[model samples]
Target: MSIRTNVINLTEFRNARTGPPKRSEPESGLMLGKGLTDQTMIDLIKKFSNPVSERDYRNRALLNLMYLTALRAKEIVSLKFSDLFLAPSGETLISYTKKGGKLAFAVIAEETLFFIREYHSTFEGDHAYFFLSLPRGNQKERSNLSTRGLQLIVNSWNVKTCSNKLIHPHSLRHTAASKLMDLAGSIAVQKLLNHSSPNTSSLFYTKPYFNASKFISWE
Candidate 1:
């Protein structure tokens, strides 16, 4: 015999839990960061290029994937080799856990896939995680890259590029979303970002499409 507990009350309990918001300011509107442009991204990638070490390849691939896939830093760090799949259409399908513990998939571009393949080729043996931490000191344990480590990677790139605004890993996500929203429609960006709320994606990522100046013509 087994006893069953209803979890609906647990939802009510969790919903009552509240604390300070993560950010001091709002995530969208005027508070949002001035995301990187395509040219800036290109320049940053060039700066990261170094043929001597395999780490450079990994860095390039990591940054490119963030920009192309619009994946969160946590999602990227949590990625395992098993989560990646090659579709019959030649697209890379990346499975990741979203904020709500929901499983989501993002399609990787061919260019991004090329870098990922290049990075993967350098690794020997079957690794549990897609990205591993660099060997440090006597620490022989190989583990996945931490979220802080990934942030530091992005910060190092930002400093090297001498970017006016501080660019972090999430900035890459914003860049991808903003750029895609501009080129494609809100629906496209919403789907790529795996946003549960289409309004949030559209209102935040997609800039005002129509020119306000056009509404008022000089007579």
Candidate 2:
């Protein structure tokens, strides 16, 4: 069965027995899970050429921005040109239009800036959307990449890298959260991630327990 089907079945069974559904808390603690490490990210950059061709350059721009901003796939896919701007200090800011049109800013990295410039140079369509799709034949309508497409891209990269790590597109967000927590603390992470509550941020800081090795460190 499909993963979603399995999940729905499991949820139905659990709810039938429990009377009311129970909400699970977000995982807490440092997790040694699969994600794009610094080296892995470098490898991806090398494997995929910049602009990779005109039609895909904007897609690549979105991918890089999502990784840097730690934005959810849906948020990234739905973003438009008007949502982006340059601040007085020369930092590129992305204004998210979700969650009651909340705004958040992330400083643009030099590498990402280069990709964005390259994408803008090659783009030809009049679409206001930052990312556009090319239609095939006369039947299919062009559209931006969906959330599922984003998931598949990450999964494909994970498989290509041949790491046994279970990396998801969301793992980029996790990595950003971890880095923010380490550099600025949980409160800063909460703000940068645009979490509605501190409790949401706390879950990312929780370390997963694995075997007894973590507790039995030799001093």
Candidate 3:
């Protein structure tokens, strides 16, 4: 069994102690903490999840899938065994329903695909939803996992890794957008993320920092 305890929200605590600001100001267009590196994320996942236990195996798969696919918590919990697809071109497709009530798919990493398979093997219950909670304290067994449960899972990992930072499952989405924006243009990241507006990707998701010295020549 994993550690069961309270998690302190350092950000909220600091904000509360500081009290209200002197004046209201316009919010910044850029979202900070959107650049959690892949290594850091994977490290936290590895640290928290033990492959020997079925629960940790499921958590490992969930965390890996969240990082690799950049899916929302609701979308992740809504997934099912049928969502996995082996394309004729040898690509693995992970399908889920988006918040906007649209069908969406993400091309998952090979490692993540393997984790999903492993999770399924160890997962108890013949539930339709891919993720489920082990029967606990008179709660009826269900096919689907709740969004709140997913939030707690992410929160637990966040607390374990960095008690001061406000990283959660949604942070993975932001990180994915930031990383993809650097590698593939914003349009590509936008499409992958299923954002209707390019402005959302540019203004909210992508980090605005860049080194001018690398691209610009000053003689």
Candidate 4:
């Protein structure tokens, strides 16, 4: 016999405006590494939306999908087409390649899919990996992008945090985590970012549970 469990929609997308700081009552995001303001993140997305070269398409995809989904640089770089799917709900689902290959998933907005498509169109070969290294001089290409290469693209954008630290891949991740935490609370952040303890249930216990990804909605 099959049992049916209720799927809860926990998503709470805040408008892209700064809220008053809760100095007296700290939020879970406060404990996280410093991240960009929501407005700044939106601005960054707009900044990279235009592409002249294939590399530009890759960068635009990185900015939109990575920021929207809160993926770690390593996971984003390690992504292959096999790890992605479009759910019946029409949301983009990604199975992250995290440390030890631990399972995780997050939903991305449909518009971000356009950026992904534009980026993938530039692939020199029909490689399995979604992000790849650019071809140099005469060498044949289509290698998966490394974490360091992801860093270079992020750096080329010259994004920085409040402390002026270059927004390395991790900083961008922090920004994504903060975005989730700010509007959805720590539980939603945990659900989206897979911040479970060894004692807790994996947020994505079953692939079917991907239906719960609505909680992390960017809208």
Tens digit of per-residue lDDT, candidate 4, span 1-219: 223222222121232244544566222224333576667777787877778788788888888778777788888877777777888887778777666677777786777777877787765557787788888988776588998998888888776785567777777767766665546655766666676551121222211113558677777
In candidate 2 the C-alpha lDDT for residue 176 amounts to 70
What's the C-alpha lDDT at position 120 in model 2?
A: 62
Superior candidate under lDDT, 2 versus 3: 3
Stretches off by above 4 angstroms in model 3 are 1-29, 34-39, 48-50, 123-125, 137-142, 159-164, 212-219
TM-score of each: 0.73, 0.64, 0.72, 0.70
Please report, in order, the local distance difference test score of every candidate based on alpha carbons: 0.75, 0.66, 0.72, 0.69
**When superposed on Cα atoms, how far off is each prediction in RMSD?**
13.4, 10.6, 13.7, 17.5
Give the runs in model 4 whose Cα sits over 4 Å from its true position.
1-33, 197-219
lDDT of 3 by residue, 34-115 (tens): 5576678668776746687767777788877876778888888888877889777889887788988888888877888677
Q: List the residue pairs that clash in candidate 3.
A: none
State the lDDT at 30 in candidate 3: 68
Q: Write candidate 1's Cα lDDT for 1-219 as tens digits.
A: 223345766656666786433665344443144577678878877877764466788788898789778888899889876777988887778788997898888886777778767776775556766677776787656678899988988887753222357788878887888888779977888898887776778778655445879788888
Q: What is the lDDT of residue 204 in candidate 4?
A: 22
The whole-model C-alpha lDDT of candidate 2 against the native structure comes to 0.66
Residue 19 alpha-carbon offset, candidate 1, angstroms = 28
Residues 1-219 of candidate 2 have per-residue lDDT tens digits of 899999999999988898785686547763335345667666665666645676567656766776677877777767666667888888777666555566665656677767767876774455555555545766445567677877776676653222356666777777677666667777877776788776667676544554787589778
Q: How many backbone clashes does candidate 3 have?
A: 0
Q: How does model 3 fare in lDDT?
A: 0.72
